[model samples]
Target: MKVLVGADIGGTKLALRTTTPDGTVRVDVEIPSTGWEAAPVDQAARWLLDRVRPVLPEDDEIAALGVGAQGCDTQEHCAHLAAAFEALGVSAAVVNDAALLVPAAGLTDGIGVIAGTGSIAVGACAEGTVLFAGGWGWVLGDEGSAPAIVREAAKAALAAHDKRRPDDGLLSELLAHYGVADAPALARAVNDTPTPATWGPAAPAVFRAAASGSASALAVIDDAATHLTALVSRLRARGAVGETVVAAGSVVLGQPLLAARLRERLGSAHPDLTLRLLDVPPVAGAVALARARYGLAGVA
Candidate 1:
C-alpha cells in the first residue's frame, strides 16, 4: 500500500494523520497552531514533521504528502509552503483546505461551503473547473462564519441596549457567554481582539439562544444562511459547478438551522440543485484526494 500523510492546518488547530490508500489515520496527532501570521511556513512544517515522524514505518518511504491548509492555495503562499516542506525533509503537494473538501465530500466536483471560525465557499466541476466565493478571511469577508454571527450578535445586543429594547434572552445570554454582565464590557472585549475566528466559539451560543425562541439570535442565524447561500448562488450562476452543493465545516454540519437555511436559499436560486451534507471529516477528504493522485482509486 502507498504511504501518505495528510495535514489540515488552520489558525487555531492543526491535525496530522498518517494513512494508507484506504484513508485510515493509523496514527494521528492534533495540536495547537502557532497562529497564521505568527509562525512561518517552515516552522509549521517542522512542527508537523515532528509529529508525523514517529508514526511512519521505518521501511516505508513516503510516496506522497498532501497538505490541506487554510491559506496554501495562493501561489505565493504555496511556494513558501513547498519550500518549508523541503526544509522539513519531505516533498509534498499543498493545496487549499477547501479544495480538499471536494474529494472529502465524496464528490469529484461540486460546490463546498465551509462554515467554521470563518466562512468561505468553493465550487468545482468534474473537469477541474474550480471557482471561489467569500473566504476573504475574518477581516474583509468571511460572511456566515462563526465569528460573523458572533459579531452580529454583539451588535444586536449593543443596539438593544442603546434603543432600550428588552434585555431578553439574546442580549442577556450573550453577555454571560462573553463574561461581561453589561453592554459596555462586551463592546470593549469585542473591540480588543476583533478577529473573526476569535468569535468562532460564540457561533454555538448564537444557535442556542435562537433555539430558545430569541428573535434577535434567530435573525443572526437566518442572516448567516442568507449570506452563505448568496455565495453558492453566484458560483452556480457562473457555471462553476453542477446542480449539487455539499456543505462542510463545523458550522454547516453542527448547526441544523444553518443547514436548513442554506438548503432553503439554494432551493430558491437553483431548484434543481440538491444540497447534500458531507458526513466525513476533511482529513478523510485529503486522503481521498491522495488516493486519486497515487492511482489507487478510480481516477486512474
Candidate 2:
C-alpha cells in the first residue's frame, strides 16, 4: 500500500493528512505552526518529516506530498518548499495556503477568499494570469481578518470611551475580554502583543457586542465586510471574473451575519456570483492535489 500525504500550514496550525485513492482519510496529524513563516526552508521540511514519519506505515512508500502554507505566498517560497519535499525522496507540490480555499471548496477554478488570522484572495484573470489580493500579513494589511477585527474593536471601544460616555458597552466588554482595567491599559496590552494568535481569538468580542446591538461593533463588521469585498472587487477590476467565490476562515464562516452582509453587498457587482462556504478543511485541497498530480491510484 502507498501512503500519500497532504498538508495545510497556517499561522496557527500545521495539519497533515493521509488519504487513500478513493479519498478516504486514514491518518491526520496536527501541530503548532509556531514561527513557521520565519523558519528556514530546511527547518520547515525537517519539521514536517519529523512529525509525519512516526504516524504512517513505514512499509508503504510516500506516493506524493502537497503543501499549501501561509509562508508559501511567494513563488520562490513555493518552489523552495517543492524542492525541499521532493528532495525528501517524494514528488511534491507547494502553494500559498489561500490557494487551497477554492480547491477545498470543490472547484477546479475560482476565487479563493480566506479571512482567518489574516485575509487573502487568489484567482486567475481573464487572460489566465493568476492574481492575488490581500495576504499582506498582520502588520501591513489583514483587513477583515481576526486580528484586524480585534484591533478595530479595541479602537472602537477606546473611541467610544473618549466620547465621554464614562463606560460604554463595547468598552466594558473589551475591557473584560482582555482582562484590562480600562482603555489606557487595553491599548498598552494590545500594542505590546500585536500578533495574530493573540488578537485573533479576541475577534469574538466584536460579534458578541454586535449581537447585543452595539453600533460600534456593527460598524466594525460592516467595514470588515467591505474590506474583504474589496479583494474580490479588485480581482473583478482586473478581469478575474470567476464564477464562484469561495469563502473560508473563522471571521466569515464563524459569523453568519458577516457572511449574509457580504453576500448582500456583493450582489450588486457580482449578480450571478455563486458564493460557497468551504465545508472541508483546507488541508483536503492539498490531498486532492497530491492524488491528481501523482496519480496515486496505482501507487497505492
Per-residue C-alpha lDDT of model 2 across residues 106-171, encoded as one tens digit per residue: 677788888888899888766756678888887788888999988888888888778876553677
Global CA lDDT computed for model 1: 0.74
Instruction: Write out the backbone clash pairs for model 2.
Output: none
What are the lDDT scores of the predictions, listed in order? Answer: 0.74, 0.81
Decoy 2 TM-score against native: 0.92
lDDT of 1 by residue, 154-200 (tens): 88878988999986688777777788878898888778987754577
lDDT top scorer: 2
